[model samples]
Target chain A: MNLALVFDLLLALMLLWSAWRALAAPNATRAVVMFIVFGLFLTLAWGRLDAPDIALAEAAIGAGLTGALLLDAVRTLGESAGADAGGARSPWRWPVLAFSPLLAVILVVAVLEAPQQLVDLPAVVERNMGLSGVTHPVTAVLLNFRGYDTLLEVAVLLAALFGLLALAQGAASAATRESFLLHTLARLATPPMIVVAGYLLWAGAHQPGGAFQAAAVLAAAAVLLHLAGLLPAWVAPGRLLRLGLAGGLLVFLAVAILPLAHAPLLTYPPAWAGALILLVETALTVSLGLVLAGLFLFLSGRSLRDEETR
Target chain B: MRVAPVLRRTLAFALLWWVLVEGSSVSWGIGLASVGLATFASLRLWPPAHWRISYAGVAAFAGWFLLESAKGAVQVAALAFQRRPDLAPRIIEISLALPAGAATVLIVNVLNLLPGTMCTDVEGKILRVHVLDGRLPVVEEVRAAEARIARMLGVTQ
Candidate 1:
């Protein structure tokens, strides 16, 4: 009845519509665009849920990075492949169609039957906030309470990059696309981007940003420079590159292990907690930036080996 | 490579850092290092172009650009509701007097931002612009925009 409820309903509808369109779109490029639109809608939904941190991550990583990767994939895979894939009707289609509604019903019933709140997690987090060093609950949870999960996340990202590197047969350097306007813009934008990244990292201690968000912004700057034909695509990891790629995980693991010498894993001294978190975050920002940008760079360039093999 | 330019760029970057961090004195240590790195990176990426910019001219252009964009948006919106819209879509190529650099970039963006006209491609000194209504004097408008930008950047005729 109220305007807010109406707006929320409209947003939900739009999200569903966009997701459906993304799946059903005929052209591969159009489908990718639709998927990006869906990601934006999902970001808005996260914001509506009052989860600004999730919204930022969703917008930057889910929508921006994923969309760029998908667009690049489309380009590399060619339009014909997308067309064939889109037009083809798989054998499992009928079975999936029949099973989807049953699954949805089961999920809805499960949600409806579940206990509302067996534990007051927020209250618990609030009570122990003083010990976490970080002022923000989300930051505390991510960096202190559940740091092992973040460690695994960085390791997973590293493993993924390693897999990408193994599969990559591209040259160390290639001809960069040139644009006068873009080149100038890239130069102008890079400084501000760096400042923003630094600010985001600093704010993470008491705000909605952290290493992941800062890393994404830093990666975006590199992507912009690459797109503008300023920065070159990466090939195999050299000594410096290797250090940059693995530095965050190394720093994080070292921090985790240091506590193991006395305390349990990943437990910093009460006095050094804030400084250690900042250190870990700084390392994560640099390493993850390289990794995220590597995800794009490795996939984009033509392989020199392809010609030799051919 | 000049000390004056390097210092100027560093100060600009420092101001930006201060603004971004909301004048947090605690961040100055990292902020100073970041500003230095940004200045160094910028110097490498962007070569000295001997640009002489007029702040007053930039202000004037910005004001005019905002007004034009608003008017253009309204006009385009009105066109959408017309019973029988008369749309003449065509691409017009024009040779620009301004050399390819910041000024050219500015004009290209200005053309793209304004409603009814979009810059599709720029090949050397020639710019290809797509216009919603071919009847509109897109060529003259682009030329006018180019002139204004040239003035703003203090580009020589």
Candidate 2:
């Protein structure tokens, strides 16, 4: 095999090995760490596949954000049960074991037997690139060609935030004590992060970034804010908070539906495509940032609340 | 909390935008607005407070910290590959003389990068640190870093 092919094989094998270790690790913490490593490997694989967008998402969301979430869970749960205490339970049981191989076989067959030429949609999308509001094919597809899917994704993020808020309200909030170190780090990092997010939002029109990756980075920064105790003890489900949760979806819907009576749903006039897409992506980034960070706050809230109740 | 740092930070962000956008003016109009919001939010969240940062001192401190941390990192790498690491890890506690702002926490955070130490928890002036090698003069290094950070923040003594 060529070097590139050999590299891909090794990466695939390593990914599989890590996946197994992540699932089969004796305790939750080790498994969680392994899973994060697996995410890093998967990101590399995606990069090798010439999908920088998915690589960024995989690293930022799949590994970084998800790792933080799992670590929070483990830390909170472990303290109560004792670190080693009942953490050895496998997420998989008999049903997963019995059904997974068949699922795997079906997936492998689907990959092997798949037609080389599935659809001419990519060619069509390329031809329509000039008419598309954005230059990036992924963005064109996500925001225009399949705008409906993105709208639903925004709604799902908002729903997750709201659901977490409901769960966190009854629980005690994480205390935000004044700490100099975290405060400084967050402050020093925030301005640059904001600029980067904005650039990503704009570059997404022609590059590998967009709302999702930018939001993930912003979410990480917000988590840093929380860690620094900059956030309030717990966010009250105030009017502003609720609006922030649904703001992206509302903006998307408004943009999508307001003109629908004149034309089909989400069919932006050719001239206004770029502006409209930018508007939607900006709103999407903010709301996504809030929702993702809200998840993080609630996760830490559980830990802080657990400590107090104990 | 002075206006100077705020202005400086805003200007710094503008420079960052240059790098991020690769000097493309096409979207600077929108990017500047985001930068403004971020600058405001950042200052609001963590004001200068009592920090009176000296640029020269900060530069010097940063240089030293980076150099020391590189050494620490190398040592840790070697230690990790050892078949049997001579174990002397311990939780050593130290109380800060610096004020209650980010000075203590900032130093603690830096200690995490300084090879063997992980700043575990802090309660007021007291710090509970986990150093990977108790034999190393990690405490001295921490004290040195803290002193430099305090000076950088214009904390007297």
Candidate 3:
């Protein structure tokens, strides 16, 4: 086989290997590390498949944010014990093992046989590019063609944050020991990060970036500031904080509903489609950034007593 | 004047925007706005400091850093290959001459990147370093590196 094919094969094998390692790791922390590795491999696979948008999201959200959350979870859960002491004793193991191979075979057959039966979805999106506000097909699909999905995604995120806040029971752990190195880094790097986030937001109209990616970068900057002890974790949502947390969905819904008086939901008039999409995406970026960062920051203040009570 | 840092940082952010946007003329409108916002944020995050970095000094320090890193890597490789390697790992606390800002941070990070010495902790002016071999003039090397960083940042002894 050629080098590209060999590389793809290697990537697939690594993905499987890492997935197994993450699932079968002896302890929680190692499993989280392997899970991060798997997410990274998945990003690479997406890149190989020529989906830069998916790759960026996977790297930023899947590998980076998810890994951070899981690591914090492991620490909070205090599950340093080996697998035998934890989840290995689940009763469903045998039935799951017995059915897994058959399911895998069925999935393989379905995947192999599906190409002829399925519509060329990308071509369909390409045909509607002129009507969709953005030039990028993925952006067009995410914000215009499938606006409902993004709205729901943001709603789910807001709900998740609300749940986190409810579960949180204390103020921020005594101001993290100030690390001068981190402070310096946060100072130097934050401006560039913000600029990059803006660029991503702007680039979404014609390229492989959009609100989600921009928001993820912004959240990363916030996390860096917290780690550097420049910004404290949230004690409670204030007026402005609440506005930022829910502003995106509110804006999206307003825009989505504005057209409903004359037409179907989210159907932006062709003349204002580009501007409307940009406005919605900008609002989404800010709100989503806060929500994503809140996911971590809210949990930062959580008390062990809450865990005990649970 | 009071406005110098603002102007300089805004200009820097503008240049950064140009580079990030790859000189796209159409993108400059948003770029200008972003540069302004970023500049404002940066100023708030870190107010003006007296430190002025010298590019010539930076280039010199970078070269020295590269050379030291190469040498350190080779030494570490040799140690790894040797059976029953003569090892004397030690943690030594050394007083830092550089001030509490960027120079100290730079040296601390640089030491971590270097092969043998690791800056494990920094408390006020004291730096706790862990070196793989204590006999390798670790203290002197750290001082030299710190001196280089201080020079680069235009900091005086």
Candidate 4:
């Protein structure tokens, strides 16, 4: 077999092994960690398949954020019942094991049976790319051609955040401490990294960096502050904070509103479209980072200050 | 009974609604009526009248936050590839300098945004975090984060 095929097989094996371990690991922490590894491997596989955007998202959101959340949940559960108390075991473990692999095999078969090449690319994407007015093909498809999906995705994110907040019912306090090394690192590294993240956001119009990537980077920074105890858990978002949350929706709505004035829905002014997209992406990065962080902290159910007392 | 802040928040929500539903042009009468109704409803819902704005503090905090997040991303990425992931798990407790509210929430949420660390709990002024690689000292990280947040909330410390 060729090198590409060999690589795909190895990745597929890694995914399967990790997934199996994640499901069967006796410890919840190990299970979560395994699942995270599975997610990373899945991203690598997607990259091999030439879907870099999906890979980036899967790595950042699926592996990184989701893993952190799962680990938090596991830690909380462990603490509540005393540190030595292991979580309850699944009663249907055997049945689940029997069924899951079968389901996976079926999925693999379906994927293999799918058509190898695009059947209507020219008419579907290339033909209508100009009409959308966005130079980026994926963005065109996401914001214009299939705008409804993008709207729904945003709604899903918002809903998930709100639902998580409702379930968790409290927030964590900030931690306070400092060391020479952390101070030096933060001072030397933070500015340049933020600049890079901004550059990535701006370059996303023609390159791989976009709202999602930029937001991941931003969220990473936010995570650092939380770790350092620089941010607090109980600080409520204000009117402007609310505005930031609603910014993306507003921009999209404005774009759609223009359609009623004889312009196509989401069609930007020709000269300023790039600038507008950049603006929207930047807003989205901040909003997304904040939303995800909020969800995690809320679910953790303790303020940073409270944490220190324990 | 405090009414002004509730009224303001209601007005803000109405404005947001208007912005969101841009093309659906209802008459000005309807918009004004809705705003008035919202304000009244909000007053009843939030019987207390206490709202504060600290713009300078928030700006400082945001500036500090952006910087902190960048540092975190690099640190976590490096940790992920380390030979001994297990040796790095550390739990640290941080003291809070701000009041229990939005600023605090922002701090904890931002912590989770970074990789390799998760906020375990927050009570009063203390914040607890679980670091994947806990061997490293977390105090400095906490101090820097606190300084930024203190600046953001206009709390002198």
Candidate 5:
């Protein structure tokens, strides 16, 4: 039919193919690689659904960071789902195959039955958006209307960081030397990446990007550096690292509770709403970056210890 | 010559913020605060005195690298479209004259990006690259790529 329909069909087919292959791929590396592709296709599908925000998150967090994590895990573990995994089939394949058709029918029915139009939320957000912090309706909803949800989302990231730290038991010596290629690329890329992260964070106020996307990009760069032996996790100072990791949740909680004078939680004064949200987003971005990067560090088979002789 | 990498980074961060905020100076205060904190954290983790890059060398290397990679992409794309593709893929190990530094790292990555070649591993001065066309003199190509990077980085043997 139309271009969009063709694009959606292609995306759906690719998603299905990749998902199937990612599950049944011969080796761990191939499986994880296909899984990454699957996630990327899912991101595109999200875009097709007209959810730019979800699409961005899916691309950065779902596809990008998750791929890096899986790759790192495979590297560290030195294998994937199975030993001598080639041509291995899942034990429950027959049962899964039998149920898949029914599940697909149910899913198709649900999709067909679901309402195509939302309940004028965008119109409402547009009208009262002046009082809300930012220009973007998504940002307004996240930072102003459903601020609690965003706060909890950030807290979950912080908690994950702590969980990773608690689980990692050993620390290896930091690699001081980086290869010429990695060192130069990291050097040049760092400047542009910094700029991009900043731009993404700022643009989230009026567009698709937000703290989560910016933080994910930052974390990816950190992972790349870590992998290259350019910036090891062990070099981070304990107190400062702890503070940066928890800073988002702390700032959000503080900001949330401070506005008791206002009618509702996180309802900032219209004049200062934009500035306040910006401050919170900045904190969230930093903490999320550190937390996500910390998780990658843990996955790298090196626990970030409190003290290290850098 | 002396350099303050930290300060330079902080200034770069400011420029980044300027572009991020769409050239608006209204949020300079927030920008300054965030830049200070990020710069401090970045400096502590990645201190100065690590890298000293030559702008001209980097510029020249970028130009050449871009051209080479484009050529490589075209070659690979053409191969993909062919009815009968010669995929004599095999891994080859070569020694890098440039030490295990920036030049070597870039060479490995660039080689990985190049058409029909993938650098699987790099240890010290030795690099293991897998090429699609094993018949081709990929070793020479890799060696030449390394030499070009070495010249750019001024990493003398």
Candidate 6:
């Protein structure tokens, strides 16, 4: 086999191993760490599949954000009780082992049977591209042709955030201070990360980095800053923050409402179309990041600062 | 002082409402009127000063919290399927960090929504919680929650 194919197989195996470890690890923290590794590997797999955008998103939102949230939850649960108390020794270990492998084999077989390549690229994507008004195929699909789906996805995210916020309303916030190591890491990483995130955002117009990927990176930087105690949680969001959150939705609504302006809905002014699309995507990245982060913090019921008492 | 805070909060809420509801075809007059009405209604319910938010801190905390939540979901799912029972210790207490306000109320509600845990009570900062698998270590969890609250209120470390 070629080196690339061999590399792909190796990465896939690693991902499977990490996923299994993450699921079965005795320690919750270890499991979270393993999942993060699994996410990184999944990104590599996506790269192999020539879907860099998906890879970037999987790394940022799927693995990174998800891992952090899980660790935080574990920490929250740990605080209430000195240790986990509801665990029970199992007698069905052997049965699980036997069944799991069979399930994995079947899944592999199913994947193998699926179509190996795209049969009609130009007809499907090219034909529909005009309706989207965006040059990027994925963007056109996500924001134009499948606009409703994208809107619903945002709504789902918002709902998840609100739901979680409501559930953790009364919990005492955690008091751990940012460690020196964390602070150092943030200082070293923030600048490059921000630049990279911006590049990703701008590149999305024509390439793999889009608002989602860009926003996730920026959010990661924000998370680092918060963790290191550089950014205080109680500082009220400014007008800019509000604008950023609503910007994407506004752009979308404007396009949807434009049909009344002597054109079809989402039909843009010829000269401003490209610029507007970029603007909308940028706004979307920021909004998504903010919304996701807000839900997490709101659910934890904690502020950014350290509490005075132990 | 109370009136001013209330006004500020109302304005914030109104702005958020306007951004969410206004469209390209919306008339300038309608947008303004809607914003005004929403602001007035919000102020009537809770007053302005009572609507507190640590926007900067929350923004930061949100990122970390999301990551943590996803991790939690996976861990809980795994525990559910695991064949071993590993019960550790269980304890309950009221949360002290959250203030006596809407923010605190929101926090308690979130605890119940997340998997592998449930909220028992919330008098002050002492919080009572029930975990799915109790054999794991949890001091860090409590500490993380406390930190999140501190961040929310803009308290300095």
TM-score of chain A of each: 0.94, 0.88, 0.93, 0.82, 0.87, 0.79
DockQ of 6: 0.02
Comparing candidate 2 with candidate 4, which one achieves the higher TM-score? 2
Best candidate per lDDT, number? 3
- In the range A1-310, model 6's lDDT, one tens digit per residue, is 6998889889989988998888767777777788888888888898888898899889878654677677767765553332332234456667787899999999999998978667786478888666555677887667666666776676677667556555543434542466544555565456445445655665665567777887787677666666676544423346886566556676667665765568766666646666666666766777887876664545442422223223
**What TM-score does prediction 4 earn?**
0.59
True contacts kept of each: 0.68, 0.75, 0.70, 0.00, 0.30, 0.00
Q: Please give, for every candidate in the order listed, the TM-score of chain B alone compared with the true chain B.
A: 0.90, 0.90, 0.84, 0.63, 0.84, 0.68
- Candidate 2 lDDT: 0.80
Better by DockQ, candidate 5 or 3: 3
How high is the CA lDDT of each candidate model?
0.84, 0.80, 0.86, 0.63, 0.76, 0.63
Which candidate order results from sorting by lDDT in descending order?
3, 1, 2, 5, 4, 6
Write down the C-alpha DockQ for each prediction.
0.68, 0.51, 0.71, 0.02, 0.28, 0.02
Q: Which tens-of-lDDT digit does each residue in A206-291 have in candidate 3?
A: 99999999999889888778777878888889999999999999999999999998999999997899999999998999999999
Higher-DockQ candidate of 5 and 6? 5
Least well predicted 10-residue stretch by lDDT in candidate 5 chain A: A301-310
The residue-by-residue lDDT of candidate 5 on A48-86, one tens digit each, is 888898887787777547887887667556664434543
How accurate locally is residue A199 in candidate 6, as Cα lDDT from 0 to 100? 57
Identify the candidate with maximal TM-score. Answer: 1
| Tens-digit lDDT string for candidate 4 (A60-105) | 6774468767776776566333232233465776788689989999
Tell me which residue pairs clash in candidate 1. none
Q: Provide all candidates' interface root-mean-square deviations.
A: 1.4, 2.2, 1.1, 17.3, 3.7, 16.3
The prediction achieving the highest DockQ against the true structure is 3
Residues B79-156, model 1: lDDT tens digits: 888998778999989998997777788888898888788888999888888999999777888878888888988897
DockQ of 2: 0.51
TM-score of chain A of 3: 0.93
Ranking 4 against 6 by DockQ, winner = 4
**Lowest summed lDDT over 10 consecutive residues: which window, candidate 1 chain A?**
A301-310
lDDT of 4 by residue, B66-104 (tens): 776787887776766879644457778878776665557
DockQ of 4: 0.02
